[model samples]
Target: MIGLPAAGDGVVHAVFVALGIAAGIAVFAWEVRRRGLHDDRLWIIAGTCLAFGAIGSRVGTWWQQVDPSANDTLAQWWMDGNRSVLAGLVGAWIGVHVGKLITRYSPSTGDLFAPAVALAIGIGRIGCLLTELPGHPTGGDWGIILTPEHAAALGGPAGVGLHPTYLYEALFQIAAFAVLWRMRDRMRRPGELFVAYVAAYALFRFLVEFARANSTRNRNRA
Candidate 1:
């Protein structure tokens, strides 16, 4: 879900993304209540994360070009730039601290967000699976084969079985969510859970990239 949407898939992608956000918010609220966090300022922090995350997702890829002149204008970037989950995560982390500063709220929020984020990403990736390029050709018996039109739209090979990379990521995230949910209270430190989850995902993503059909990866292979 970190790339451009396929032609006419934008609305569908947005809907799933909205659903993911709703799910994340619901989980966050539930965690807050469960933890007996009475402070209303937590909502402000959550809102800040959402706002900054959205902005970061849109703007993160704008600087891919080294020359400023080669980059899109800010407005153009917002409308057409590639989005990235990692950027959104970084933005959310920054938002947490900014929100804390504004409201003078203290205490780590990572535990509450860890499972919620995992679940949200797991759901959000379904949209990507449906709408984006699946991945490179698998050269094996099993994978999704795109119709000619879908292949053309998504920049994939028609009739070729391709790795469902997004689905792989989605499954990983869902499993991580389950694991994080079970370990939610086991961690003694405040931010350790979040750090561990993010680090694990980063490693997973790096490994998964080799199976992806990204232009950069293709170029590297060449």
Candidate 2:
């Protein structure tokens, strides 16, 4: 995050993001195809929402962590992993509604994605854990042991076991999936389940931060 020329901010991570966008689109596309959404517009609308949502989520995460004067340069602050998933969730909502205004898609599309987005969150948390990135790392009883590669990637001196924050997030996301699944059909509104999921995930993250190593995150990664 610290060494990129404007390219990092520009399109340096383009491929990775495109892959993520494609994956998200593919998820929505699978839904559309499975449900027989013959309206090509549905694909367009879903694509637009997922695309903008991904950008907004990552950018929002970056924006939340950026504080000028905290670092000599903006990039320094913005590159930290301390971005806001909450903001990204909001972005996803906005992207869907805005795409609806532009494409006339219905809220049902958002409903279609309710469980999906949660699954993605749960999946992405695994990426975070595999790298052995820093976290609270308390009680050795239930944490992870990293290989030399993970340690090197995370700047650990090697032979150290981290708190396994990625695993924590993954487990919590699984719980979130269960709760949302149970509530999806019983809720009064199409989006209520999603709101509950967001709130629940936020609480989960807040609680888990206590086990993370980044004291600043433990203090304030929300």
| Candidate that would win on TM-score | 1
Superposed by TM-score, candidate 2 places the C-alpha of residue 212 at a distance from the truth, in angstroms, of 2.3
Candidate 2 regions exceeding 4 Å error are 1-39, 63-84, 106-108, 132-134, 146-152, 156-160, 214-222
- Candidate 2 C-alpha lDDT tens digits along 120-215: 666655444433344544445444544555444444433444576656777777676667656655888766776777677778778877767532
User: Each model's TM-score?
Assistant: 0.92, 0.66
Global local distance difference test of model 2: 0.56
Question: In candidate 2, which residue pairs clash?
Answer: 61-84, 135-212, 135-213, 136-211, 136-212, 136-213
Model 1 lDDT on a 0 to 1 scale: 0.80
Model 1 alpha-carbon drift over 4 Å, by segment: 1-8, 215-222
For residues 18-83, write the lDDT of model 1, one tens digit per residue: 888999999999999999999999999998888888887777667868899988899987776677
Clashing residue pairs in candidate 1, if any?
Answer: none
